[model samples]
Target: MLIQKSGHIIVNNSTNIYEEGSIFIYWEGFIYGFNQQSGKKTIREFFKNLQIHGFCSAISKLHGSFVLVLANEEKQEILVASDASGQMPIYKNQDMISSSLIELTERTDLNKEDLSLDKAVEFVLTGFQFGPKVLFDAIEQIPPSKIVSVKKRNFFLINRDKEDDPFLRTVKHDSISEYLNQWEILANAIRKEKVSIDLTGGTDSRILVAILNHLGCSFETAISGQPTHPDVIISSEIAKHLNSHEHFTSIHKVDEDTLISDLYEIAKNSKGINDFVGMHRLFQLHKERAKRGISLALGGGAGELYKDAKQWRCALLSCNSKNRLVDKLVNTGFVGWGMGSQTPDQLFQTEIREKSANYKKDTKKFLKDIFPEYHKCDVFRLADEIFYKYIIAAPRGFSPLMFPHYSPLLDAAFVHYGINLPKHLRFGHQFYREIIAVLDTKQEIASLPTTRLGMTLLPKRIIPEVLTSVFLNLQKRKTTISLNDPNLYSLLRKRLKRSNILKELVGIGLLNPKIAIDNIPNKNLGRLVSLWLFLRILDKRKN
Candidate 1:
């Protein structure tokens, strides 16, 4: 399912290629792809017909993810193309042959080196690599919606200018009524086999469920954590109200035994430790769903599309208010929950100021690159543009995991609708209020669920007062209890001595210098200690 070239690998399901479906073929000293459509018979036939001298094109018009490579035998050249939105990864190194010749040997017969250390660090910092850069230095991933050609060792890249094409049509809508009408377009976009909904007691998921229900689509719902967990209880209630079947699961503490057994397997398979915790749980859940023959799953993964817009409105309000907005924001959430004795007002201020400064700088650059003509737009407009470019589009990486995973909210139509809404309609607490209203009007919720498992099953009174104290301190600063806290350091050291989990955390913390430095005594060593213990478990498994 995975093929590697020059340290980059492509994943695909080639064994079962349906007629009129997409297929990845490794042939003629290169990779080739054929997409079956109205006029095309086989991919090979298409390639054969388009036999231009000293050049070959690997056209990938399929709906799924793949890398298409075309090599001209006479010219000894190769051309590659990848799907739009970067669903597939295609990497190349211009110096691969030379590098391989120098480094390749019997012990290391592989033709390429792993991702570069600097690139990998950058990925850790940014979450994803931008442009042609990968986690490796010499190797470069081909950008999505692009073609890379090599003719007699001369390289040329051509990007599909979707934004510049005048012939491409644009859909225009008027007022909220037209926007609401587009819901049908969104509903029709949901195409999958054995669909399941990751239902939550929230508005986004509720709206999706209602829409799907209206369309007469059949779907089962799945919820995670104990019955006491807020999402679980709320989702279960919603499912019941909707008269739908549901599956629920619980996740307790990730203990030493589980970490030790599963860490290495996960790391080896995934190739990195970023988001290791969440990914582990997701993988388990995905496997479980896969067993039931569910190839496609839907969730409120893009719920943030609407919710975050509302948050931005609040942020803007705080920015304009005489009263410090940070204080108000901090007080409203879990950040206000007291955990430590430390006064974090100054730290919080500094962090927010730094972030604001960074945001402004980045927004300026983004505007210059993406909307040079819109130079006259105000900060608010620029902010909206940045949001669409960064946050809304950033999570596409998580989408392909569905394989055939389909997210109604993330669908093209839904996103277009969500993005073009008037600023007045897009911002403010009313955004969420409207969604909640829709849920209630649609009767998308069942009953309220209980609290988290740890909170409900574990006696709150018995829980260490220090933990609460630490949390309070973090809340005061609008931050989490970090490893640098003395209390957390002492706790982790004690845990390390007594628990294998703590030992493993220490090991991983040591390996990742950033993790170690971030938890250095000044920041919050206690929190670092806890994270280190987690990392230790991860490290042990990786080894």
Candidate 2:
């Protein structure tokens, strides 16, 4: 933890924590080049580099799922930053900095009742809160590409040196070849160590498999799901095609009682940032792998940077003004993610609804503050960037805390490349397909059907993309795992009945207590449950 006291900065040392003359460094998750090195060694080298080249210059060359904190006694300040993709999250309060949101709550006066109603509405409508602000007004996330400097109990933003900042580096829109070349550097670097790949029935993981196979990297594949599930079947096919050993962990085997308990624990740890429904399986899978002497695993997180345009298709392209664009961005994410259209109106009180009218207006200013080029970027690119940082980065970054994980695609080099690529190529996932086609030299992997895409990659057609989007939109409506299951529903209702936080929200006109927990709409149940669980945890800490 980094704290300010008596007008001085203090840093506590522990594992993965490094200290030098006047600099104390602590980091989580592994960087690409430092994967084989101990955390101490990585920090030692970072400190040395900092001494030679300074802060921003030292971090510019580093990449992967990491969050770094440097407490400089000489400078009397603490510096915090995350990886290029912001895969690891760190939060800041008034005078303290910590990676765990729940920990921050305990260390500060922030309670469940201090929650931001606008952010609450946003979280219920979209799966995650938008912008830097979290559920509480006092805690805010540090942006991915910028540094947060703490001095005399105050926070200041420090921009990275633009010339070396990968996200800011300009490349031609058609620089796909260059992009792949840069991607291969990180890919090959990661491949040097024996790592397990989280193969799934999705475009992202499949792309990883194709690239690794093309490069002749020896690695195993793992999937978590029932044998009958599409992900299991498709991932099995990909593994068989590559002649790679595959591991399957059935989600059905988890004990119901234990799963429910784990759900609350996950909610507490993630502080409601992650939807805990399917997360347990991944957590269990990694735990089992750790027991088998496997720690490092590669995930296909942040892959949407290459192909996410649904928001643009539905609303962004037609947006006429800044406010219109903000409304479309927020609404599209809310509706596109399968949170019901009625949630905003049904989940909150009348006063909140009136106040939420300014959410879009506020979000416009927020985006402009964090992303200076917000007004200049095309709608498609802007939407992708917003969704990447705000919606997906938190949960994806939090996954590593459960186990050691890295996403080769989430590397800074790829982020720069993908963000700069023309939006036309990404509109219908043309860029993703093109990369898969180029990498799947034997053509076998492309023939396998993707569980989400509902088709093989060989016959790339617009019809499949359209049909897939429609199918996903329909599936999002039924995302009520806890509510639909009799056992889980019973457990959820019992816990929610005991929730003082839920009652308080109702008292404050943020939640409608008249609506029974069991009767909450299917589309809104998972998010509501997550919020309830998070608040209940905070209430526990407060008491």
Best candidate, lDDT: 2
Kindly list the per-residue Cα lDDT of model 2 for residues 236-338, writing each as its tens digit. 8888787555555445455555655777766754623655654556666666666766647888877767765455554345554544665666554432254
TM-scores of the candidates in the order shown:
0.57, 0.82
Q: Which stretches of candidate 2 lie over 4 Å from their true place?
A: 5-13, 33-45, 152-154, 163-167, 173-177, 188-194, 216-218, 253-256, 268-272, 312-327, 334-338, 349-375, 393-397, 459-509
lDDT at position 534, candidate 2? 73
Clashes of 2: 1
Candidate 1, which segments miss by more than 4 Å at Cα? Answer: 1-11, 16-84, 87-90, 95-132, 145-156, 161-171, 174-192, 268-273, 304-311, 314-381, 391-404, 428-543
Error of 2 at 350 (Å): 4.9
- Estimate every model's Cα lDDT from 0 to 1: 0.41, 0.65
As a whole number from 0 to 100, the lDDT of residue 77 in candidate 1 is 51
Q: Which ten residues in a row have the lowest lDDT in candidate 1?
A: 98-107
